[model samples]
Target: MSEQEHWDRETDLLVIGGGAAGMATALVAALEGLRPLLVEKTDQVGGTMSTSAGTVWIPGNRQSRDAGYGDTEAAAAAYMDALIGALDHTGIRAAYLRTGPQAIDYLRQRSEVRFVPSGKHPDYRDMPGAAVSGRALAPEMFDGRRLGRDFERIRPPIPEFLVLGGMMAGKDDIPRLINRFQSVGNFVYAGRLFLRYLTDRLRYSRGTRVVMGNALAARLFYSLRQQNVPVLFETTVQSLVRRGGAVAGAVLRTGDGQTLRVRATRGVVIATGGYGHNAGLRARFMPRPTPELSVACTSNTGDGIELGLAEGGTVAPDTQGPGAFWTPVSVTRRADGSRGVFPHLSLDRAKPGLIAVNSAGRRFVNEAHSYHDFVEGMYASHREVPTMPAHLICEAGFVRRYGLGHVYPGTTDLGPAERAGYLVTAPTLARLAERIQVPVEALQATVARYNDMARQGRDLDFGKGDTELNRFNGDPTQQPNPCLRPIEQGPFVALAVWPAEIATSTGLQTNADGQVLATDGTPIAGLYAAGNDMASIMMGTYPGPGTTLGPALTFGYRVAMHAAGRPVDAATGNGGQP
Candidate 1:
């Protein structure tokens, strides 16, 4: 590799990683009248945020209040106290609680980012601090055409999440499009969306209208561009430049194998999207039998964490839970020979007429639980029996209505999926057990017990639909228990699911100001971390929809303010007392 000797660039602030946190850092710095340079290792921006649902769980945010929810800071604090319960990172938690709404307000007022509270989205656990709704906020849908030619620079969502090869849909769009056959209004709404998508395809390589995480990423990307913050794609930091024991800049390596020295006068922010794909780090930090599947950006291989560590930053110690965010994933090989891991996040698992059984063909968990909780069940089940590859068995009618994994609902052609061995089908329950390699009698008895409970509209075995969290992701239109329909219909389908990580909870330790801290509990000057690169504020607890993103945005804002020598008042948006 050819390396350049002289300084190739200079800026007030340098933000590494193009995901939400990095973008927020650069955006805030630019807004504060500093010249910011953002670098992304990938060919495009958006990192793992582009592939997510784009929701941020920010308690006491204005959007929630504006949406007529009575969520207060005290309520949020009480909830956190109940859930976190004497963790060491209370300072980070306090900072997040105080600054989260401020961050949202700043972004809404100054940037293109717009968030609307998911008024009905419940917290992940039904603990004392949990809210039934109004804490999670999602980015409003964005029109990709606004970006013009720059639209191509925004990383697209996962291929499996799209419809008709390109169009991105939101949570609400799914039911509308799927139920179009039942209602004329739904049919027209879906028709218009498809029409818009088809027209967009004629002009662009993919649909120009985007939603969810893609939209959130696009909004941030648009804001950065609008602020004239320069972002270098396919560029990464090789090493942090230190002067007087403080990070001064970085030695950057470009995609063409050329290296250049870049100086930052303010600070360098590390936002590389965690260590999800780094095998060595995973083996060290994760629980035994480390997950091989990750839904995070493939480029996220712990570059930022390693860089911070090399610069004398400390990693947070292990907590009560696994130091990684997890989800159950189903894999499919595309025609192009690339494997696609579809995360079972609120699509089919929580809905009625579904049951997840281990290799012994026994039900082990409440099927309607959150994805993180579902993986916990897998881990627990694995301790007893072989449950690494659990099967999500659903009836033919459920498959036709709700779809399993990557298989779409009302799919006329199962030829491609069947050829790829992604979908296992059997006309009888015994046959399904045989095909999936589970015991026949065990499977039959499990379904029989489940059917009796479903008929009574109650889950006596595991209380599947008992909690608000379970019902939140379920089909509300169902009679009696929303998440408890019987899976008695034949021509059954079963999709194999594996433990997969969505994000790493363990990361570089940082203080309340988002400054990277040393092992001796002192902040490393001019060094900061945000997004998944920073140890999670929740301390590995899956609080709600946007726990990762909420802290990411808040700390990104904090890092920029601290670097700019601005006062950070957590109580108000304008740096004032409440």
Candidate 2:
């Protein structure tokens, strides 16, 4: 049959969404000798991992397998259960834990993707059964220039957390950040970032080659090319075509509005991310007054989720479960009137002795908790009070010493929000509280209570004195009470904070191998989902470390292997890498 008269294109596998998961899936399929077509709607790839911190928390990972650390599946399972508590689902959790190591090992051996242990970044639980040091893995830095013009398409790391130019930081460097003389390593690291920027500018006419997010994505993109994977950017899967209740192929739409019907001989993998960007889905699942903020890629809009739902798949935690969303982040408007969001609270919670309170004049959680925990509490608080926003309170010392975490357009040279004062500032705690519309007396009393505790060298109200991560954000110059010092300096500030959905964890339900399943427990033949597009295997709970990317890549590989008919290695219990 003529090419145009017959099916538009035929491939063994069609992987949608070119993020970490989709890229990994296509790579595996290509390696398995299956011609794979990768569809990424965005101009570039690397979804959130490209523009954000590229850490993949894989418990009992092979990265630490040689360090003499014990990381059995049982141990990892226990750690997950402890961290997420009664909220986690055992079946899905077990699959994630058991398959994690093999997943890491497969990627390491087969692709340019490499990881190093995130030393000292503790599990959400300091609990037993957790690998003390091997639980987290971040992408080793890669040069973005390798992708050529594709490098320009990929999203670079946001600069708020990026001190010099690099957007990643060592786990131990969190606390040592504020200590000017003491943070010699951070200083040297900053110097290296600066050097990376200069080198990239001279060689590639781009300043982002050495950074974390773009670098990681660039590596995966390059590796996918080397493996001969067919990546089709600026293209989208319009709908999944079915034959006898099985996915047959997809109706694809190109940037030029050309429609092509491609046959998926094996399966169609949907890693198109969740519906965070879709207002209708967000309103349906999330509680009312859901702000239109998303830290995830703009490209994620439930395209895969919608297609799966239309194909009669069930989406679980569909209505509830921590709302299973990424937290609202602090952002400022740029000169172009675009907003830049930053997740770093290193100074606010750690060094500036800032106290976060809701609109109702109360502290809801330990301000020093992980970013995810903070968002969960924000969601809960918004539900409790009909109020639309929360406040981040910091004092003069915080702004003067640590810098009120600035958000810039593309880089620092572009317009920043710090100059705009979307970050509200005031002379007194009372004035700051009043300006932000919180009850003044209540705010003062809260600060006074914190000050009393700080002077006594303790934190009785909240366990701020607990972790090194907390102390890193504390005022070490204040003696005895590093994290306990209250926001006492003359000028205090409070920013209007809201919970921005980075990506919804709640999504289409899938089985152990990343195959979408009907409510009756039968697999949807020739259909698969991964990344934020797939239902979170951890249930509604966020596990410690690289919770997002871990399952994303793992399941991506699983779907490709299954599609390619690769044998499952019974000994390793890992399905063969495609």
Candidate 3:
């Protein structure tokens, strides 16, 4: 243990983790005239955010209003009430609703972080409180070149999510690239993107024009750099230092194996990503038959939660949903020997000719449902049979047009994937079922039923393409039901997928001000939490896109304002400026 006498450095605010929440905290604190120090366990800063779509689910934000979508705090509250009863988590939800828009306003006005409404992206569920559109917002494309050499410090997107070796394609870019050969406009678009990517490779290690979460992370990083905030990568908090019943500082361990005590006059904020990768914590907090796959950052091992717990912070109780955000992910080993966990968010599952089946070869879920609901369906199916690893079955035409998992569309070669056992391929549905170890007759029956439904453009059993969300991810060019297509082609393919977590919902309990609270429902003075370190305001139910990030940014803003002694707006729950 290092001696307290050897104090190395000090700051007014110490922010742990380098994701959206942590960076937001540090950035907001700095804007409030506080000297803040940010430390990251990994060499990079983005954490799991780099791998995401970078959508923030803040209802009634300026983006939505400006885009002519009429939404209100009351309306959003109504939706929340419908989704997860009105009485549950009323305070947290109210805090989020009030502060979220203000947080967006602050970031857009003061920092490089800019967001726009995600056009027509609907809420995850079609319940009473759901909005048809205009709730989710996504970060605009950011030029990573603005960060100069620091751009390298931004964690790149997941390898499987990229296209053409290292180039990142945004949501719009996907259709352009997939249809490049079909239309002149798409060809030009694809050509421009590839040419830019090729030119970028000549100088930078990766493309400089980034989108999605990479854009969001890079924008925040650029903001931090502009603010002169000291971000120390490869450094992590070992433990919190308590003095007179309050958190005073932290003992940090550097990448070089040196320990240093750093004191914070204002407070220390724990934004450490989450416990998604911590086996012990997962076994304890997560549901039984815990998922082996995690789409979160590798460094997210519940370090912040553990540190908070050491200081007497308590975890939020499990309620209606799983303690973590769930997704179905397919795993593949890259040529470099690294395992790639490809989260099935919106790429293929809902794209016309695909169906996810259990070991009994029965379709158990609405394939076009949101990723969270899809995994929930997986768990529900698991209760009935061995569905821990469900198989995503698709036909050759589907694979050729829409792709499966990391295997991109129009890929000329299936030999490598087949040899690597990532994909099970067969000429017939029965043979494919045999290859994947599912019952042949059951698979045949399931496909027959699915085919009959597809022809009529109706999914009677599961309602696959009924919702706006389902249609959004479906093939728009398809007739009748965009998500309904028969799998009559030969060479059927099956990829095994398992339930995976993106972020933990149950975490250190915090108040509306982001103050870390003890089990007795009292604040632990000078201790704060944001991001996954703070218990989710949604109470484990994912309402829409950006649910994790919206509250994270809002609470992060609240925490900084409270710590800096800035004037918080009573009506809006934000600080200083409106």
Candidate 4:
């Protein structure tokens, strides 16, 4: 087996983790005349990406230009300069800005991975050069039947993201589903979706008309299957084997408890996500009084980062702002009593007639800003007040119109949410404040002030609907300000929100070639990292909608190209042998 190049013991590249970055590495490596093998400790693939929105922020792509988006390299640079505001890591940024388009083009042409321009997505920040839509690309939906029986191997979306028991409801489908009775087109679409789901439920555990992250994962899985690449599931890389002071292979523990030493001649890519789920790392790097919730998969317990560190790599030091990308999450008890961690990413936070309040029922930040900014407000307000478990206050009318977190729109009976302890409801604001344990007088005062500001068409406390991002997420039908509406309706409700990570930006330090760097700033010859395992190119600042995924997929391509004996050519935005 060791003598044969194609057997289990030998391969050109050994990729650890079945997430996007690792899959991208192996797929690209296979395309470049290399024999690659991927080993994932988790039984199923995709990791945290399976539950994500699956938008990739790529500038100067062909798809966006074709969609009439006016995005340019110069404009993107200005946007980055405004958000990052430093000359640090200029080379890496330049490389990413150069290699991104090439990476997307490569995968689209050679593999099953395909992305299209999001019709109306906007940057998280409305700064200079922030085009409304061109920069963020969404993965095209893929059919799970393409994978045959392997469809079961792809991880499902977050349970709360599904509707009608096991049917996935993407953001694009929600509006149509909600308005199905109002429009014939929507009714037809909704009917078709339900029919497909009903048929799929008979054969599959969940509906297979997958979208978002599930689609992306299914596409990657299909591509690897087509290429005949071997991905050993439920396999753990116990220790890295080094030869001539460079990583050459790893000792692995198979799912059935068999030990195997696999040898790699090319390189090793660590893409097991970040330390988002690691308790010790959360204490070391996250905010004090450490957050107990994470949106990342539980398998992402700092495996890749720790592996890189043991191989002489250092944690990236150029990070700024929050180490982890933050979002407000709500907890619910599933049917079987398991905890359901639902991340509030762009569903209902920025809508009209809703306001986020601290423990004292006082408004703190702009409700229409980015989720990252929303969590930053939580941390800031927590300094002087107890804001850890803030409540998103809204009326029953707000719930019927916009829904509150996991509670679907038009939910008349609040008994289910109340019984599950997921929502608080009362007949009046005073009762609601008492129920949620906030000051009743402060709650009344805050509501009155907010209503006044809404009627006056301005936010006196914090500019709510001021930014382009804010207005984009708001209800456009509202006259004065799309994000402003008085909470005058009764049967008030409140959903508890807590700070949690959507992704970790601080990770293993690496060079422009995507090779992990030693503590002294030298690249490790045969060790590479990507996805969240690699240090964020944005210096921990989330500049736009798909910031994390954009760099993640791009660096995955960069590292794989490097291992294929070709680094990116800065001038041409493609690879060249050095």
- On lDDT, the candidate that comes out on top is 3
**How many residue pairs in model 3 have overlapping backbones?**
1
Clashes of each: 1, 8, 1, 0
- Which ranges in model 1 have alpha carbons more than 4 Å from their true place? 1-6, 88-90, 412-416, 570-573, 576-578
Ranking according to lDDT, highest score first: 3, 1, 4, 2
lDDT of 1 by residue, 14-66 (tens): 99999989999999888888899999998888888999999998989998898
Residues 1-578, model 4: lDDT tens digits: 43445335888899998988888888888888789999999889998889999888888888999989878888888888888874855388978887788888888999889999996778888788787878888899888877878989999987788988789887889989998999999999999999999999888888899898889888888999889999999998888888788988888999999888888888889999888889987887787668999998889999888889999999844464567888999998887879988887777888889999999889999988788889988999999999999999988988888888888887888888998899999999999999999999999999999999999889979988888888889999986889999998889999999999988888888887789999889888789999988888887677777787788788888888889877776555457321
Cα lDDT computed for each candidate against the true fold: 0.87, 0.70, 0.89, 0.86
**Alpha-carbon TM-score of each model against the true structure:** 0.96, 0.89, 0.96, 0.97
* lDDT accuracy of residue 484 in candidate 3: 93
User: What RMSD value applies to candidate 1?
Assistant: 2.6
Preferred candidate (TM-score higher): 2 or 4: 4
lDDT of 1 at 84: 76
- Candidate 4 lDDT score at position 353: 91
The better-scoring model by lDDT among 2 and 4 is: 4
CA displacement after TM-score superposition, residue 421 of candidate 3 (Å):
1.5
